[model samples]
Target: MEIKGENISFRYNIDSDWILKDVNIFLKTNQIIGLMGSSGSGKSTLCKILTGYINNYEGDVYLDGEKVNNNGFNPIQLVFQHPEKTINPKWKMNKALNESWNPPKELLDKFGIQQSWLNRWPNELSGGELQRFAVIRALSPKTKFLIADEMTTMLDAVTQVQIWQNVINIAKERKIGVLVVSHDKKLLNRLCDETIHLNIPFKIFFI
Candidate 1:
């Protein structure tokens, strides 16, 4: 399976400056790739576009040569920078985690999520702890591609390393394509197979 973005351009309004323009990417299944750019360079914006979060863009996104549909749970999943924005405030952590599927113990354990935390609400847990649930939710069995947009930014270095290691293991085992979107050059160099830059036109200008 390959996910392709062709000539993607997006703006909040016609009068607003374009955030992304003419971007093209060909991401095949089971590969880990890195996307990096300066702040406000549209890296996160493009991540959202790829996973159907922002569907009003000009370009077409295709999976295995078919146009990507914006229906229910997408085969392409995205974990955002802020966990608080993604989860429901009224739901318990367990309910939020199980919203899509009952995640296995191994997944919870890998992220160091204690069983006790499941009973609490989103506000009770720290940002790092809550983000564990967000990542877990995006890693459901139905997910074919994963976009991690600064997903571990709130975590400490050690926790970041641990989470990334587990993510790589899961991706390799499940044959899931992953897009590691971040400004951290060290992290990108450590995890990604090939690195691409996002700038005006969104072309692969650099390796």
Candidate 2:
């Protein structure tokens, strides 16, 4: 399976400058793609467009040659930099996680999520712990493509490596495509099969 964005372009409003323009990208199952850009280059915006979060853009996003349907469970999932923003304050961690899909106990263990932590509110857990849940939640069986938008920027080095390792293992096992958007060139180099740099309005060149 593949997710393809064609002739994509977007701006905040009529008065604003285009953040992304005529940008194209592709990701296939079992492949890891890295997207790099400086600040204000619209890397995150493109991720949102690909995942159907922002639909007002000028071009189209397709999955396996068909236009993506935003209704129902989205095949494309996005994990944001701030996990807390994605979780509901009123819901406990377990409820938040189960909303996507109930992952196996071993899967939870691999992400280092403690059984006790599931009972706590999002506010009670540290960012790293909450991020673990966020990552696991996005790994639902229905998910075909995952766009990680600076997903581990806040974690310590050890924790970041641990989460990425587990995620990569599961992604490979399930033949899921992954788009990792990050500023860390080293991390991208370590994880991605191919890397693309996004220039303003954007020109994408594979390396």
Candidate 3:
């Protein structure tokens, strides 16, 4: 994706507290970079700014060396903490999945999700199942760079590991750029090629 952000800073409101401050970061194409921080340490805020969710920011974000013009959907897509929030409750799995464009039918089998689940509603699925669906939906046909924001936080440990495995496998195979934002040090270490700690100062490492 070749992303770059220069001194990025953001505040919720003018008089309110700033979430991110003077954040400078970049990502090369086809690399998995982890964004790690404590809760409320501006990890989510950084994702938002990167994805153009909260545009009223202090600095510029560039994709492929070009300044990100404020468009609706980012080339850099996000997988939210809760898959249910990203997937529509009113829509069936197929309908929700279709929102991302035409996904290959083979992908469902690859993810170990049955074809029957395609006709089911979001409420009918387990958290892990929903999360898997969300991942496929996000990565299927249109995604370039993914900002996975605590994507497995709601899943069980077993499911979390499985999902991460699938993601890492697919990411490597596709050579997709990934920015995984999480508080789990272990997951970051396992899944990311490089990890960055978004603390008082950003500590980045190639592991």
**Which ranges of candidate 2 are over 4 A from the true structure?**
204-207
Q: Write model 2 residue lDDT over 10-57, tens digit each, in one string.
A: 999999899988888878989999999998899889888888889899
Clashing pairs in 3: none
Q: What is the lDDT of residue 12 in candidate 3?
A: 89
TM-score of every model? 0.95, 0.95, 0.88
Which portions of model 1 miss their true places by more than 4 Å? 200-207
lDDT of 3 by residue, 1-207 (tens): 577888887788899876777788887657898888777788888887877777889988888878775465557777878787778789998899878577787777666688899899999999878887888877864567788999888778887887778787877787778998888888888887788777754423321
Between candidates 1 and 3, name the one with more favorable lDDT: 1
Clashing pairs in 1: none
Ordered by lDDT, highest first, the candidates read 2, 1, 3
- Which lDDT tens digits does candidate 1 get at residues 135-183? 9999999889999999998999999999999999989999999999888
Which of candidates 1 and 3 reaches a greater TM-score?
Answer: 1
Give the higher-lDDT candidate: 2 or 3: 2
Candidate ranking under TM-score, highest first, comes to 2, 1, 3
